[model samples]
Target: MAKKLIAESAAAPESFEQAMAELAQLVTQMEAGQLPLEASVAAYARGSELVRYCAAQLEKVESQVKVLEGDMLKPFAADGAGEGMQ
Candidate 1:
Protein backbone atom coordinates (compact mmCIF):
# COMPACT_ATOMS: atom_id res chain seq x y z
CA MET A 1 0.00 0.00 0.00
CA ALA A 2 1.11 3.52 -0.74
CA LYS A 3 2.04 5.59 2.32
CA LYS A 4 0.37 8.63 0.76
CA LEU A 5 -2.97 6.86 0.62
CA ILE A 6 -2.57 5.91 4.27
CA ALA A 7 -1.73 9.52 5.15
CA GLU A 8 -5.15 10.70 3.99
CA SER A 9 -6.76 8.39 6.55
CA ALA A 10 -4.84 10.20 9.27
CA ALA A 11 -6.71 13.41 8.58
CA ALA A 12 -9.34 14.57 11.10
CA PRO A 13 -12.97 13.44 10.68
CA GLU A 14 -15.91 15.79 10.44
CA SER A 15 -18.12 13.92 12.94
CA PHE A 16 -16.37 12.71 16.07
CA GLU A 17 -18.89 10.05 17.08
CA GLN A 18 -19.18 8.54 13.61
CA ALA A 19 -15.45 8.61 13.19
CA MET A 20 -14.89 6.82 16.49
CA ALA A 21 -17.49 4.19 15.64
CA GLU A 22 -15.99 3.64 12.22
CA LEU A 23 -12.56 3.32 13.75
CA ALA A 24 -13.80 0.74 16.20
CA GLN A 25 -15.46 -1.20 13.40
CA LEU A 26 -12.25 -1.11 11.44
CA VAL A 27 -10.38 -2.57 14.39
CA THR A 28 -12.92 -5.35 14.70
CA GLN A 29 -12.65 -6.12 11.01
CA MET A 30 -8.88 -6.27 11.31
CA GLU A 31 -9.16 -8.63 14.21
CA ALA A 32 -11.31 -10.86 12.05
CA GLY A 33 -8.49 -11.05 9.46
CA GLN A 34 -10.98 -11.90 6.75
CA LEU A 35 -10.58 -8.96 4.44
CA PRO A 36 -8.70 -8.99 1.16
CA LEU A 37 -5.32 -7.26 1.01
CA GLU A 38 -6.66 -4.10 -0.60
CA ALA A 39 -9.64 -3.79 1.72
CA SER A 40 -7.45 -4.40 4.74
CA VAL A 41 -5.06 -1.71 3.63
CA ALA A 42 -7.89 0.77 3.14
CA ALA A 43 -9.36 0.02 6.57
CA TYR A 44 -6.02 0.51 8.20
CA ALA A 45 -5.77 3.88 6.53
CA ARG A 46 -9.29 4.92 7.52
CA GLY A 47 -8.77 3.70 11.08
CA SER A 48 -5.81 6.04 11.47
CA GLU A 49 -7.92 8.99 10.38
CA LEU A 50 -10.72 8.07 12.76
CA VAL A 51 -8.26 7.84 15.62
CA ARG A 52 -7.04 11.37 14.88
CA TYR A 53 -10.62 12.66 14.80
CA CYS A 54 -11.53 10.98 18.08
CA ALA A 55 -8.48 12.39 19.84
CA ALA A 56 -9.17 15.90 18.55
CA GLN A 57 -12.79 15.74 19.73
CA LEU A 58 -11.72 14.62 23.20
CA GLU A 59 -9.16 17.41 23.44
CA LYS A 60 -11.79 19.98 22.45
CA VAL A 61 -14.18 18.74 25.13
CA GLU A 62 -11.46 18.81 27.78
CA SER A 63 -10.48 22.37 26.84
CA GLN A 64 -14.08 23.56 27.05
CA VAL A 65 -14.54 21.99 30.51
CA LYS A 66 -11.33 23.56 31.69
CA VAL A 67 -12.48 26.98 30.52
CA LEU A 68 -15.81 26.65 32.35
CA GLU A 69 -14.08 25.43 35.50
CA GLY A 70 -11.61 28.34 35.52
CA ASP A 71 -14.38 30.94 35.37
CA MET A 72 -15.85 32.40 38.57
CA LEU A 73 -19.16 30.64 39.05
CA LYS A 74 -22.15 32.78 39.96
CA PRO A 75 -25.20 31.82 42.01
CA PHE A 76 -28.59 31.40 40.36
CA ALA A 77 -29.56 34.68 42.09
CA ALA A 78 -33.17 33.49 42.02
CA ASP A 79 -32.13 30.85 44.57
CA GLY A 80 -31.46 33.74 47.02
CA ALA A 81 -27.75 32.94 47.10
CA GLY A 82 -28.36 29.96 49.37
CA GLU A 83 -25.37 28.25 47.80
CA GLY A 84 -21.78 28.64 48.96
CA MET A 85 -19.87 31.88 48.38
CA GLN A 86 -17.61 32.33 45.38
Candidate 2:
Protein backbone atom coordinates (compact mmCIF):
# COMPACT_ATOMS: atom_id res chain seq x y z
CA MET A 1 0.00 0.00 0.00
CA ALA A 2 2.76 2.45 0.92
CA LYS A 3 4.81 1.51 -2.11
CA LYS A 4 1.76 2.02 -4.27
CA LEU A 5 1.31 5.48 -2.81
CA ILE A 6 4.94 6.32 -3.45
CA ALA A 7 4.58 5.20 -7.03
CA GLU A 8 1.49 7.31 -7.41
CA SER A 9 3.32 10.29 -6.03
CA ALA A 10 5.93 9.96 -8.77
CA ALA A 11 3.52 11.76 -11.04
CA ALA A 12 4.26 15.29 -9.89
CA PRO A 13 1.66 17.06 -7.80
CA GLU A 14 -0.61 19.43 -9.71
CA SER A 15 -0.13 22.29 -7.27
CA PHE A 16 1.51 23.31 -4.02
CA GLU A 17 -1.72 22.78 -2.10
CA GLN A 18 -2.03 19.27 -3.53
CA ALA A 19 1.52 18.42 -2.55
CA MET A 20 0.98 19.77 0.97
CA ALA A 21 -2.23 17.80 1.34
CA GLU A 22 -0.55 14.59 0.22
CA LEU A 23 2.39 15.20 2.50
CA ALA A 24 0.05 15.71 5.44
CA GLN A 25 -1.77 12.49 4.65
CA LEU A 26 1.53 10.61 4.46
CA VAL A 27 2.58 12.00 7.83
CA THR A 28 -0.66 10.89 9.43
CA GLN A 29 -0.39 7.37 8.05
CA MET A 30 3.26 6.98 9.04
CA GLU A 31 2.58 8.31 12.50
CA ALA A 32 0.01 5.53 12.96
CA GLY A 33 3.00 3.10 13.10
CA GLN A 34 1.11 0.32 11.40
CA LEU A 35 3.21 0.10 8.25
CA PRO A 36 6.03 -2.40 7.76
CA LEU A 37 9.66 -1.27 7.58
CA GLU A 38 9.65 -1.24 3.79
CA ALA A 39 6.44 0.75 3.68
CA SER A 40 7.82 3.22 6.15
CA VAL A 41 10.90 3.71 4.02
CA ALA A 42 8.75 4.26 0.95
CA ALA A 43 6.61 6.79 2.76
CA TYR A 44 9.71 8.63 3.98
CA ALA A 45 11.05 8.83 0.44
CA ARG A 46 7.75 10.13 -0.90
CA GLY A 47 7.47 12.63 1.93
CA SER A 48 10.92 13.93 1.09
CA GLU A 49 9.88 14.38 -2.53
CA LEU A 50 6.75 16.24 -1.46
CA VAL A 51 8.77 18.51 0.79
CA ARG A 52 11.19 19.31 -2.02
CA TYR A 53 8.33 19.99 -4.39
CA CYS A 54 6.65 22.36 -1.96
CA ALA A 55 9.92 24.18 -1.28
CA ALA A 56 10.61 24.64 -4.95
CA GLN A 57 7.11 25.95 -5.50
CA LEU A 58 7.56 28.45 -2.70
CA GLU A 59 10.92 29.56 -4.07
CA LYS A 60 9.40 30.13 -7.48
CA VAL A 61 6.62 32.25 -6.00
CA GLU A 62 9.09 34.18 -3.85
CA SER A 63 11.20 35.02 -6.87
CA GLN A 64 8.15 36.24 -8.75
CA VAL A 65 7.08 38.35 -5.78
CA LYS A 66 10.53 39.84 -5.49
CA VAL A 67 10.48 40.80 -9.16
CA LEU A 68 7.01 42.26 -8.83
CA GLU A 69 7.97 44.21 -5.73
CA GLY A 70 11.28 45.26 -7.32
CA ASP A 71 13.09 43.52 -4.44
CA MET A 72 11.84 46.09 -1.93
CA LEU A 73 10.62 43.47 0.48
CA LYS A 74 9.50 45.18 3.66
CA PRO A 75 9.40 43.63 7.10
CA PHE A 76 5.86 42.81 8.09
CA ALA A 77 4.34 44.99 10.78
CA ALA A 78 1.57 43.49 12.89
CA ASP A 79 0.01 46.20 15.05
CA GLY A 80 -1.03 48.33 12.07
CA ALA A 81 1.06 51.50 11.49
CA GLY A 82 3.23 50.93 14.51
CA GLU A 83 5.57 53.95 14.57
CA GLY A 84 7.50 55.06 11.48
CA MET A 85 5.23 53.14 9.13
CA GLN A 86 4.96 56.21 6.93
Per-prediction TM-score? 0.62, 0.82
* The candidate that achieves the highest TM-score relative to the unseen native structure: 2
Give, for candidate 1, the lowest lDDT window spanning 10 residues: 1-10
Q: Per-candidate RMSD vs. true structure? A: 7.8, 3.7
| Local distance difference test, each candidate | 0.70, 0.88
Q: Candidate 1 residues 29-85, lDDT tens each? A: 779887778878888867866777688888888788768978444445766665586
lDDT of 2 by residue, 1-86 (tens): 77787677878899999999999989998999988899898889889999999999999999998988898766677467578756
Clashing pairs in 1: 9-49
**Count of backbone clashes, every candidate in sequence:** 1, 0
